[model samples]
Target: MRWITSISYKNGDGEVALAFAPEIAQFLVQLKKHFTSYQLSKAAALRSTYSWRLFENLERFRETGIWEVDMDRFHTIMETPKSYRRNFNDARRFVIDPALAELAAKTNITAQVEPIRRGRKIDRLRFTFENASQMKLAL
Candidate 1:
């Protein structure tokens, strides 16, 4: 499902409208119950697209503090390109690691990736993280 379908705004007027697909609308309804919402200000401050996407993904599992995603599905979710898909190391270095680093440095969360392997090849990634404020409170 696409995150956004179309956006329209007047040239000089202070009015705008966004049209989302039915699936996106349903997703938003479901998000209200299962997801932890982030402040728009904070989200807008993120400079990297990967960082923003990672934050949203992790926020959905904020309560659980852990998320497991297959590498293929993760790549799809991140909208990774075909070239990067062929090299796991490159994908990790350029995409996943940078995203995680940005999230840890700029946001209220921190995460680590644990690669799940099938024989000798990496297959999935298990992300474990916690809200920094929550961690402080627990300590």
Candidate 2:
């Protein structure tokens, strides 16, 4: 579907406006929408595509405060390169670590990764995250 059908200047002060497709507008108006404008802005501000993808996924579990995924699923979700898929360190160094760090730096969310091990190999990655505002409310 066409997410946006038209765009125009709404005012003399250079304010712009968008006309979204009917289905897109209706979806946005629906209850329990997938994300907020703030989250989308934060994701857009990220430099790495990896960070953007991770931020989008993380927002889904923002309230729950944790996101866990097995190695295979993580690779699929992140869309990592062949080298990264073959080596956990490569994935962490090139994809996961930098993405997490960028998200922490650019957004109000902080995350920590815990890699679960199965014998001599990494099995899954657990991400525990928190919004700064939520943490402040708890204090």
lDDT of 2 by residue, 1-139 (tens): 6799999996768898899998888877775665434445556668998998888878888879899999999999989998898899989999989999988878878999999999989999999998777322212
lDDT of 1 by residue, 9-120 (tens): 9888999989889877887778677657777755675798888988898888888999999988998889988888888889889998999987776777889999899998
Per-model RMSD to reference: 8.2, 5.9
What are the runs in model 2 whose C-alpha is more than 4 Å off? 1-38, 134-139
> Model 1: how far is 125 from its true place, Å?
0.5
Residue 99, candidate 1: C-alpha displacement in angstroms: 0.7
Every candidate's lDDT = 0.84, 0.84
TM-score of 1: 0.70
Worst 10 residues of 2 by lDDT: 130-139
- lDDT (Cα) of model 1: 0.84
The residue-level lDDT of candidate 2 at 15 comes to 90
